[model samples]
Target: MRRLLLFSGLVGALASCTTASESTTSTKPDRDPVAHSTIVECILYDGMTKTSPQLVTVTAGTEVQITDTVDYYFMKARVVKDGKTYSGYLQRQCFGK
Candidate 1:
């Protein structure tokens, strides 16, 4: 009876260890993909002035393909202009590249 109890205890310990290891190895997906279509030049419009238009020259189009799809806490867009690439977070209202 003592030997049987010892064997049962050992088996329980091994099962608990296996369960802990499996839980630790699990990973959660958080990053999400940004949807972008055609690239186009976007100008920032001034809200105060109604007559004259203030145009910010964006050399590169906005459309960019997402290399990976994951839920990123922040949405980032890469803009290429004047042979240089610039990366920045997308404004809340901006969409469709």
Candidate 2:
């Protein structure tokens, strides 16, 4: 009975360690060198191009984080609405300085 208890304890410890390691590894790291800005008024496209499907129509004063600049006209941006994060392309003119 003592050996069985010891074996069960060992298995429980191993399972806890595995769960901790998996949780750490599963976390997603944030993008590097990002700039926070506000949306003046724009639509977040699914792709860098305007022809891509429109994801959402962000209103003026909405907060956004600029991840990448596609060009003078378009930029890769991330938005948060209703506690959910949204990523897509936005026009440069729609961002405030």
lDDT by residue (42-85, candidate 1, tens digit) is 43323222232533334344564333322332234454556775
Per-model TM-score versus the true fold: 0.34, 0.58
lDDT per residue for candidate 2 within 6-70, as digits (tens), equals 99999999999998987845567766647555546789899877799999988888778888777
Query: Listing every candidate in turn, what is its Cα RMSD in Å to the true structure after a full C-alpha superposition?
Result: 8.7, 8.4
Q: Name the best candidate (by lDDT).
A: 2
In the predicted model 2, the residue pairs found to clash are none
Judged by whole-model lDDT over C-alpha atoms, candidate 1 comes out at 0.48
Question: Local distance difference test, per candidate?
Answer: 0.48, 0.82
Question: Could you give me the TM-score of model 1 versus the true structure?
Answer: 0.34
